[model samples]
Target: MWEVFLYINPLCSFCLKVEQSIIDFTRKNNIDTQYHFVTTSNMETINDYMILKGMKPCDLEGRIGVTQDVYDASLLYKAAACQGNKKARNLLMNLQQEVNTNQRPYNDETIKLAVEKSGLDYKAIMTEKSGDAVKEAVKKDQELACKMHVEKAPTVIVFDDEDPTKPGVMINQFGSETSEEIINENLIAMLEKTMPHQISEPKSKYYTNDSIINIERYRR
Candidate 1:
């Protein structure tokens, strides 16, 4: 099994695509994996998102709640995560697609639509969105990013759960066609190297001169 921490901006198009690819790859392979979708609260990351969208900081002045949208989305994501990781991920993906693909604003309407589409309890999320616990969760995510020295969004940290002594592998290269392939290869290699091997004694039909013994090895 692997523990993956993916730090991303909920509104970043590139981050959305990369997240989808990673999820598809893991599900396709039926890998035992845990994903932590950490929405970044850094200004640099927000600037990068704006740059990717071909917008300057000045443009945000006219769009109300634009700057605060990032933090708001982060809170919403954390609230959604209280229900389930999948729901939280779906909410982010929906928000990204609306903002990036549909060219929609991250306002109340967009957030509501995304939450509805993500199958979240709107009442529950709203009740918990600004709660102390959710705020603490978001703060913890920020602390984790600082501890890991993550200064940008769309960063992935892969930890080999079987071997905790080893450091987590950091992946920050993305937004290229080859990024998916690169991540896929790295994940496969890590699984091969770190996944535990099992050996069991097999029932033998024939006995040897000394004993009936057969050893079977399986890699998972």
Candidate 2:
């Protein structure tokens, strides 16, 4: 009954490893989990975050270099999310896998393969060029990420159904750690500690109202 949201960017080596770690942890522990993939470019998001945190834009790496192709791919990911959950997760993860694993830029063939594996028509998703849809999806996703206060890639927030109000803890760069076993153990502990009670179940009588983490408190 607990929910865990994994904010990830597939292109990062660390993120890819974290994804694998989560998968292994879930499989081994028999946990039901949900992954919310953040398709935004980390550098751009970080720049915005720094500014929001009252940091100066002068410190940002705008002129340092960012390819438009990556931005385009981000939009594509948002578009996928809009269609459905299954399609979105599959395509988003697969595309990220392809992009991260590849040494070259985004290729039609690679993207197509990712789409097909996701049970989608690669050509149709590619051909649909509705500006508003892509724009709105990307905007909503960015807004959500900002609301989540995510500062980096592959950051995970674990929630316990029993305590629903308090999210247990979070982890950054779960994958590619020196010890994968340790990482899994830590995640399992967090998962066990954070899961919230389901709506079908009784609410906690001990909730003092002081320890609850109100999701609405998050500022955009």
Candidate 3:
């Protein structure tokens, strides 16, 4: 099994796209993957970062001026993760879809909708106790992001299952002007390099040399 640490923010459109691409890639390749979601910022300062990244502040729907609400969403995600990985992922996906499509605010109402969408026990996971634990988890993830020098959203770190001491390879799709296929191909190439023997026989359709070359060309 491979561990892929994905640093993401709820407001980042690029992160949303990249995460889905990774999920699709993993599913198609039949790769056993453990995904860790990490947040890089709260709502307080994310707007400035968005502008810096050449994105509109309004792209996140109800996220523009809401201070710490996005962080609250991250906490909600962590609380869901305590129940199970699938629940957590579903909540995150639901929240992202709401924000990107419906322009829903990252408030308690949105959290409720996400919980319902994820099929999680709302009363059980939305307590003060779970909130405290989620706060700590979010703090830990932020610290880990700092240690890894992750300054952008949608940063993926692929770790080798056998070699614990070796440094992991990081891949980012934040500022890339290329297509999602190229970004996914580069990410798959990095994963292949990390775990050479673990890849299955039938390759994913997106994993191709031409895509890799196209990504390199875009970089140049």
Candidate 4:
């Protein structure tokens, strides 16, 4: 099994499509994988990050129309992950589709709709949304991203095993017309280079305290 740390922002269109491609590629390859969807957008740096990633200022201004804060949306994503990673990933996919395809704002209403669509424990999530545990989870993810020196969304760090604490391979190049085949090939090549000797069973490790708590929550 492999673990991949994926840094993304709900407002990033490229991140949305690229993540879906990676997920599809992993499934097609029959790879046992775990995904950590780290929400990397902050209120301070989101506009600048978007522009640096090649989004035109005029277009961004038009799209947002007004100041749109994404911190709450990011926190919502972390809360969803508390329920389960798969559920969180599904919620993210739906949220991204709503934002990118339907031009929906990243707001409480949008998040509520995504939560409903994902079939997660809505009451639990809502209750925990403002709790310390959920806040810590979101903060931990952001801190991890900073520790990894991640400067952009859609950045993927692939580990040979389920533990991401160990050093991993980072994939920095994702083309405009990125395909599942291309992603699969790149991942295979990286895995080969990183894990030349295959181990029978690798011990799984969580990157943060919040991760461990979430896994336990899923089990209960």
Candidate 5:
């Protein structure tokens, strides 16, 4: 019963792991949540933004080198998002893994391979590169990142916008939970407090520092 603004990239294994965990948690617990993934048609620009953020401009394998023009890659991500399909998420996730794990000198074929493995309509995703829908969606995402202060990948927030008296927001701090269990533990309690639902609540002693969220390389 909370609106979770999960800012994540598909390529990040950490992101993938966290996402999978969250999905599992929701299904097992029957929690109502929403995901806001920023990938697909905005690939190139986000990468550029990452480079601008100082990620070495190359994958761990050094396979894909950076280009002066990042338009195509940026469009790849944003355009995929516009399609509003799970395939787009798959494409971005596999693409991220490809760049992160592959060897150096990544080229068109490797990218194509990542796309194929993701089970997306490669032709459709490619065609979307030139379409206005993807371009506009990418812009919107960028603007959103700016407005929402998401400067890092995998930015997660647990929020409820129903309170009317104070009706503000409670931000979550990352790295607060001592362990994975603690993370889920605290999340359940917080969710109940915000939505008052029947769920397995975590121990609240975890809030010693009174922080439930963390901002990683994310700046406003």
Candidate 6:
């Protein structure tokens, strides 16, 4: 079993990309996995993320002025989680696609469309999204991010089933152009590092001189 904490900024392009990658990774690996998301509370972390990726502060300031949008989207994501994990993931991906892929504004209309696409209970989601409990949930996510020392959006921290107290392996700073395959590779590598026993060795008919050759070695 694995526990993955994915910290994201709803408005971040990199976050959207990594979100897809993480989804793909989870499906392909087929390990018993529980995943969670932590949303950014302020623009400071987003700014820092972009700057670390070589964005000039002056240019970035004008582009990422939608702090309120981020907060609202964060709340919506938390509210979506109340329904179920799958539905929440659908809503999150749909929302990101609308804003990042379709270039739609992250306003009420876009949010509504995303919720509809996700097959979510729109009225219930909206009501909960505005409640203090949802707001507190979002705040708690941010606090968890801080505790984990997450410095960038789209960061993934993977914990093995062995020790609950360990900090876990952190996967971060993928470039905007990073492919899902590459991200998956990184995830697998981290898993191997953290929980080697969980990874299955490929079976083969032939044996090496010393021992059976690992199928993974051929592609290396």
The candidate, 5 or 6, that scores higher on TM-score is 6
* lDDT by candidate, in order shown: 0.71, 0.58, 0.67, 0.65, 0.53, 0.70
lDDT string, candidate 3, 27-77, tens digits: 887778878777678443476445644667787663444436567777777
TM-score of every candidate: 0.77, 0.69, 0.74, 0.71, 0.61, 0.78
Weakest ten-residue segment in model 5 by summed lDDT: 164-173
Superior by lDDT: candidate 3 or candidate 4: 3
Compared with the true structure, model 2 gives a TM-score of 0.69
lDDT assessment of candidate 2: 0.58
Q: Whole-model lDDT, candidate 3?
A: 0.67
lDDT for 45 in candidate 3 is: 42
Clashes of each: 0, 9, 0, 0, 28, 0
With a 3 Å backbone cut-off (N, CA, C), the pairs that clash in candidate 2 are 159-194, 160-194, 160-195, 160-196, 161-195, 161-196, 161-197, 162-196, 162-197
Estimate the Cα RMSD of every predicted model relative to the unseen true structure: 12.2, 7.8, 8.0, 7.7, 7.2, 9.5
Best by TM-score: 6
TM-score, structure 3 vs. true? 0.74
**What ordering of candidates by TM-score runs from best to worst?**
6, 1, 3, 4, 2, 5
lDDT of 6 at 23: 67
* Model 1 spans > 4 angstroms off: 57-65, 175-220
Best by lDDT: 1
Model 5 lDDT, residue 54, Cα? 53
Q: Which stretches of candidate 3 lie over 4 Å from their true place?
A: 42-49, 52-67, 128-130, 174-178, 196-220
lDDT of 5 by residue, 1-220 (tens): 5455556654454455445656677677776765556532144435643553357545643323333223455577666655564666666666666765564234567668877786656677778888887777667767766655555555555545344232213323334322565546545655556556565455355432223333232222
lDDT of 1 by residue, 105-156 (tens): 7788888899999999888998899899999888888887776677877876
